[model samples]
Target: MPQITFLLPDGGTQTLEAGDAPTVMHLAIRHDLPGMPAECGGQLACATCMVDVPEDWRGRVPEASPDERDMIEDRIGSLPEGRRLCCQIAVTPALDGLVVRIPERQG
Candidate 1:
């Protein structure tokens, strides 16, 4: 199991044990963390599950797929270096202690 930390929009931090969750989005939705609406669930359709990965942990997470990058660009007009759709990030032991900041609003 990996531990994922969410930096919420309200300036609060939430750390949760990711247990058997398949992805970061699943863990967020499971915990009902603020700022993660995930309206389209884990599908790649909605960009509602966006989160900003800190620079220090960026290398630990996989690079976003081309399609994922396009979707984010389409929604936000431009892709920031750390912005990612949590649904696309698979949970694994390698990602223990991963930290992501939730945007103030979903796309």
Candidate 2:
């Protein structure tokens, strides 16, 4: 299983072992982590599952799809520099030590 580190809004960190969760949003919802309500579940319709991919990890993770970018940039307005919809990020073995920052609030 891979491991994921969630940087909370309070400046704390939660590291979880990714079991069968398909995406980062699923992991957050499964563990009931704050800052990620994921009201729309894993669907692309909701921007509630936003997370910030640190600069170092940007190269490793795939770029956001066109739909995701449009949702964030056009609909949600300006977010953090590395803002990404966690729903679009697959939980893969290669992301074992992935670290993501949960914004203070979600759209």
Maximum-lDDT candidate: 1
TM-scores of the models, in the given order? 0.97, 0.94
RMSD of candidates 1 onward, in order: 0.7, 1.2
Q: Cα deviation in Å at residue 13, candidate 1?
A: 0.5
Candidate 2 runs further than 4 Å off: none
Model 1: residue 48 alpha-carbon error in angstroms: 0.4
Highest TM-score, which number?
A: 1
- The pairs that clash in candidate 2 are none
Q: Candidate 1, which ten residues in sequence have the lowest lDDT sum?
A: 34-43
The lDDT values for all models are: 0.94, 0.89
Candidate 2 lDDT by residue in tens digits, 48-90: 8889999999999989988998888765677557899999999
For residues 1-107, what per-residue lDDT tens digits would candidate 1 score against the true structure? 79999999999999999998999999999999988888888889989999999999999999999989998999999999999999999999999999999999876
